[model samples]
Target: MKTMRIWFGCSMGLAVSMIFGWSYGFFAALLPMFVLVQADRWSTPLHVQLVLEIVWVTVQVSLLVGFFQPYPLLMTTAVAIMMLFKCVAMQHKSTYLFGFTGLLIGSILLNFASYNFFDIEEFSINLWMCGLATAPITALAYFLFPEPECATPQPVTVNNEVTKDEYGMVRQAAMGWTVAMIAYLVFNLVI
Candidate 1:
């Protein structure tokens, strides 16, 4: 059942995205497969949650870009500071998903906003559309392949090593962001 849902949602989403050639349409593929795997039930508010997440990130990126577009130095600094905050917040115990989504979408949009022709409004609308596209696909995936009834529900484990987990996540997030920023700088220099 899980396999069917993943395969159907991902493949169908990829197909639809490719066919329509939407700028931010990859969300259609990613969200459905991701939510399909993460959701325990079909009727969860996955679609709404995803939209809100995307919208929040979009607003963040748009405002930063809009305010700093004329000054490249300020733009870079603002983007770096925001990314650092997102990276650190993403590793925190309580706000992982929200920060992670912001980091993912904000990084991409920020990079694109470097170009003058980039359209924030269009991207935001298309992003919402891509999110909306997930609802029906997820519903279909759930309807077609419902979770099997298991006699025993698996036990959920709580991690007691809060400091260890948070430290490791912070270290990893910093390393990742550092490497990404350096690479972006080097690539820009080369290009």
Candidate 2:
């Protein structure tokens, strides 16, 4: 049931994005949707999350391959950002208010930052449109799925060490953002 909802959200989002010339939006929207469905839970298993991310990214790349310049970095980086926003949205619950706030604030800040850093055009409709749908999709998925489980981990201290989980959610999230950013910078530099 939960899995079905996630797929439904992704399918809906992908359909919308394709119509609007933002195929990446589908993947971006999924982050929040997935998180929203699992929000009540403390954490999801890393492997399961990774599989979803890979599948989403693959679909996104395949869909947009015909139109956009074949820039793996750009596509992957965008996916990373979508995933991050989804994580944040999930942590905050699937409230439309939060989603709206993130869309507005994030869009403004991201556009402004791009203008300053990349010196690119301001307020890209495609980018902002993606942001607009990101939160709603997440909320919708959350509403559709049953409340997530509240898993409790063992007590931890400075003395306790942690092991890497699959999907390397934390690590990949960080690496994705970093690599994407670096790739963007390099692209800008070369172009």
Residues 1-191 of candidate 2: C-alpha lDDT, one tens digit per residue: 56766676677678777777663454455544545454443233422343343434334433433333356566546634654564344233233233333333333333333333442122234444554565566556556765555598656668664654645655654664465455545544554
Q: For model 1, how does the per-residue alpha-carbon lDDT over 43-98 read when each residue is reduced to its tens digit?
A: 55556766678888888888987898688678778877877877777665455555
Q: What is the TM-score of each candidate against the true structure?
A: 0.78, 0.36
Local error of candidate 2 at 170, Å?
Answer: 13
Q: Clashing pairs in model 1?
A: none
Residue 5 error, candidate 2, Å: 3.3
Top-lDDT candidate index: 1
lDDT per model, in order? 0.75, 0.47
